[model samples]
Target: MHSDVIKISDKDIKKPKGKVFVVYFSSISNNTHRFMDKLDVSDARIPYELNQELIVDKEYVLITPTYAGGGGDTKGAVPAQVIKFLNNENNRHLCRGVIASGNTNFGDTFAIAGPIISKKLNVPLLYQFELLGTQNDVESIRKILEDFWGEK
Candidate 1:
């Protein structure tokens, strides 16, 4: 681990700065939702739960589960909801980055959704968290957002 990375507890994660949004989709297990809970940002929303207007007014991060490629392969597919949302030309500009979740048991394919999103959407692959995420992962995410937003 880098020296700059701090370990934050669940209760101590800092909220994202500026007009940040976290769009996610949780299917099968609730692990994606559980990971979203670790975020201090209040703009967390599931695609299905959102209204007709899928375009966010500000820059945002997408957190979604890997729907395919769970073996030793590194190629993974994005969730259906996320793909639909991203398919909208209007909504594409709102995305700044992505965080993908997957089981480590998948080996090289674990959290492969991030790369797929990053490549397709032309955005950064910010982080890849294990199922439900760890407290350390949450803290590292907080730090990354802070740095990205130029916040202290």
Candidate 2:
């Protein structure tokens, strides 16, 4: 079996002032986790358990997988863990933007969580990708974050 691993160079990782970080919630499928692994940046994962505490004190971007299914209603699109994490007043205030992952097969509901959270939090929906995402997605996200944070 051939194993493929992406090695990130130190120079590729931007060390922005004030340390804008990435926070994500991945379900059992772990597709969002796989996507986050491709980016070279500081990140925290929202635990599956609602009782777990995760308080991000600094500005950060949130990456989440959309879970909505059928009829394009967007009900239950955002994971409970993500909702719990964002419900924290501090966390909600510190969030700078959001990136969402979803299967396009869901039509209008694809990546719905991004827009929903963006509106609720008054943050921008930075990006959206399907499933694990491609290399281009990773590069675009890198540039987006660098520009958003005004890399020093």
Candidate maximizing lDDT: 2
Query: What is the Cα-based TM-score of model 2?
Result: 0.86
TM-score of each: 0.77, 0.86
Expressed as tens digits, the lDDT of each residue in 5-93 for candidate 2 is 12334454333347658999998888888888898788999998888979987888999998988465788998999999988999988
Error of 2 at 111 (Å): 0.3
Candidate 2 clash pair list: none
Candidate 1 lDDT, 1-152, residue by residue in tens: 11212334435333335855677778757787777687776455555543543666666778888766655454336766777788777667677777888777777677788877777666767788888888998898877776766667
**Each model's C-alpha lDDT?**
0.69, 0.81
CA deviation > 4 Å runs, candidate 2: 1-17
lDDT of 2 at 141: 94
Error of 1 at 67 (Å): 1.7
